[model samples]
Target: MALTAFVCGCTGNDRSQPQAVVILGAASTKDLLSDIAEAASNSLDRPVEIEISTGPSHALAQQILSGAPADLYVSANRQWAEAVVDADLAEPAVDWLSNALVVVVPADPTVAVDRLEDLASESVKRVAIAGENVPAGIYAQQALSYYQLWEPLSASGKIIRGHDVRSTLAYAERGEVDAAIVYATDARLTDGVRVIARLDPASHSPIVYSLVRLHGESPAADAVYQFFVGDEARHIAERYGFQAFSVSQDEE
Candidate 1:
């Protein structure tokens, strides 16, 4: 993504501030930002506006580099963040948060799936997962491949592919897919969804969030950044099943 600074504070008396915060959000983090944006009108003490375009992380990254007017960049993985920083579109990178991978079953369980590995059981006829390109899907693939479940599970013609994490979640929530792979956050949001297992962080690729400030930093932009890394934002994310980023012993 090309480098561009974001507006820092409330633009004076102007009743409407036309702006957009571009997020390479993994289907899970979008809601947290939306809630904060809704309160912007009052909390920002000025006219506030936001727009989001979502897809696979690669797609979002491409959009940003193609001169997409993104005020800030938030990504589901550090890889995308590093891409932007490498391109000089954003400042030095910082990992902001994390989420855990989980297996989900239908809201009304006719087919019972219990463990992360249970997804491969012959009794489970169909399972849904995000495309390999999506982070959630990538994590799922890694975990199953570790357990050597991918080939056996796919051989049964039971693995259905969703375009993104949320889609796979929808499959489980609606009972369209007997089981699905998704982020814990997604499972928490969908009312009919039930979580069967959360992958131990050590069991698969790490789930990390990377946030960067667009060069034209504004008060609103900074506020968004500050809040995301702060306790209030962490709580908002937790309510929806997101595991807040924790400092590792290495950092301490």
Candidate 2:
């Protein structure tokens, strides 16, 4: 009887353990999403362990395409999210947040360059940027093309490409590049880098973040998705310099 009771107790404990909700998100939202996940776990009183994977939005989407097991997908751009939805790996994605881009330099000046045009000056040699496939890079390319600087800058052989926005920011923070184009929220996240100029909204497409619930249909995924779209999550995202996605009050 004692042995049977012990086995039953162990089984019950194993069954009660929290289910993990795997979230694949853009590197830009890492800090904010972690906080939101923690808050949601507490409020819902559900045994949910949020496992997050962060990287360039495009790469994350690719991982999903390759059969990666992700319960939720939050991307820095709708383009990548749309890819996942179009592939039928996820339901239609919903707009979650908005952001803007900025040009940044190391906190300690290597030269007195501060404006977009300064990137063309002799003093600024290498500029760090995300890969063209990443949304930040796409937007940066568009902005530079709009200013008629893209061709010249590309020819100069001073463009340093990073796999993601965070990597580009790292290059700037370490002074590996004279300047970097990154999201404004990324600029705020690090004191090692200083914002020099914000890209005009007209320069490129409006930056929008989107979220989708990947196929799998689990209770844990549903709960986390609900928490993410709730008012509290919006407040947390806004605190991190992201604009809300215009969810109706009733929806909240």
Q: After superposition, how far is residue 82 of candidate 2 from its true place, in Å?
A: 1.0
> What overall lDDT, based on C-alpha atoms, would model 2 receive against the true structure?
0.84
Overall lDDT per candidate, in order of appearance: 0.70, 0.84
User: What are the models' TM-scores?
Assistant: 0.82, 0.91
For residues 36-89, could you state the per-residue lDDT of candidate 1 as single tens digits? 455443355544455544566656767777877665666788887778778888
lDDT of 2 by residue, 58-160 (tens): 9899989999988899898999999999999987788889999899999996877679999998777898889999999999999988988788889998899
Q: Candidate 2, 241: how far from true, in Å?
A: 0.5
Number of the top-ranking candidate, with lDDT as the measure: 2
What shift in Å separates residue 195 of candidate 2 from its native position after superposition? 0.8
